[model samples]
Target: MTTTAGSRLRALLADGELITAPGVFDGLSAALVARTGFKAGYLTGAGVAVAGYGLPDIGLLTQTEMTERARVVVEALGDVPLIADADTGYGAPMNVVRTLRAYEKAGVAAIQLEDQAFPKKCGHLPDKELISADEFTVKLTAALDARTDPDLLVIARTDARAPLGIDEAIDRANHYAEVGADVIFVEAPENLDEIERIARSVQAPLLINMVQGGLTPDTAPDKLAALGYRIAIHPGALLAPYVLHGLDALGRLGGTMPDVTAGPQGLFELVGLREWSAVGERYRDNTKDGA
Candidate 1:
């Protein structure tokens, strides 16, 4: 049998550098990130919820929709590894098995499954409930077994920190590692101390989510690396800025009713469309000449 996608991700994880995987919602965003030279990308459920349905990440999106979106992103990024968020494995142990297979076939490099209960909310969100550690362990095992490729990295995320506490979260992380999770993600560690504590406690590779205006304060990637985190995903960094800037521009244009043709050329000038068109003309001429 051929090496699996899971094994490829594990190889990247073993390299010992903090993989900066920016959250990508669509093919365009994934392509843009790959073009920017990042080695890996993350398919965030929050980004998908906001971009695809204009809804909150409150379990509104279905497993099929998320899997389909991952397929598009994986295709767009080509060989670049993608770590996809499969929230709560979309159900139970059996569900996790299916999710792993789906993501593996879609060419995702890793699949992250959280331990939140059914109809789970985002980790940063409030009023979260968690399944028992033993329950989640079974799901994690299923995820590991379901993967056809050993290289398809299985990231076990514990949302127990907020509801149960940091100690419990660490315990769950240890359990996940025992159950064959390639990486452990202890979500929503509120302070710097907890971050350092989890990094110190968890022996397996760890992944951290850096979200703006969320439970955890914003920290630099270098700072996180210093604490021993192997992967850091900033899912909302680009999306948040784009949302605010787009709204600002829309409000200004709609309120002032400015003449559309009055402003200076923007992206067209930035990209030099005329130059590109001239190059295309040359290519067309070459094709016509059979060169």
Candidate 2:
């Protein structure tokens, strides 16, 4: 029997291996990560906001928009499991029910829901507020109940470290896991000690987000695995590099770069031109003589 993508991810986590997922914004970035042999990929909301809408991660993306982005990345990734960041489930508890179904339909293996209130900000941001634990539990329960496939992992994240402190954040994470969160994410631990505390305290499978230039330290993946994190997602791995080098590339360019500047076929192949061309050739030369 063939194992499904979600099953693959669940098995990877179960086997005691630390799964590292690179954050990808679109189909091309997804394809790149898939080609590079990463076990999983993350569809990050922050990446989607800046890449798709040129905005900040300030609760601006809609549910439909994020689903569409995940759909495309899922197609690009084929059998690779994608852990999608479904920010705050798009609204209240009822909205979380629908949001879960939509993302499942989009073929994501894991869905992450945070405890931040509506109009959520990025996890690394300061002055962040969180909804009451009871309120978040309702949404988390809704997500757990809404999934038809049991293989789909529902990750519950708490952004209360800066606001409520690490101990409270870990408490919330434990409560979320007790309430049906498949994995626990305590976002933005300030130091190594705090990071270690979250790892040692949380009983369930844990996820660590390594945001470039964010609150978390540049702890190595092996270190994180040793610290008891089962899954590590670098959500801005591509976005941060892109912004930094993109500025330099733009400055160096005397004029607007042409379509075919970098690669042999330019940006066309980046969009799968060769594969698409083969598909087009099949139709264009379907003649009697196989022209």
- State each model's CA lDDT, in order: 0.82, 0.85
Residue 91 lDDT in model 1? Answer: 86
* Candidate topping TM-score: 2
Model 1 pairs in collision: 5-151, 5-152, 6-151, 6-152, 6-153, 7-150, 7-151, 7-152
User: Over 4 Å off in model 1, which ranges?
Assistant: 1-5, 255-291
How do the residues 214-236 of candidate 2 rate in per-residue lDDT, one tens digit apiece?
A: 77887998998888899999987
Q: What TM-score would you give candidate 2 relative to the actual structure?
A: 0.86
TM-score per candidate: 0.85, 0.86
Best by lDDT: 2
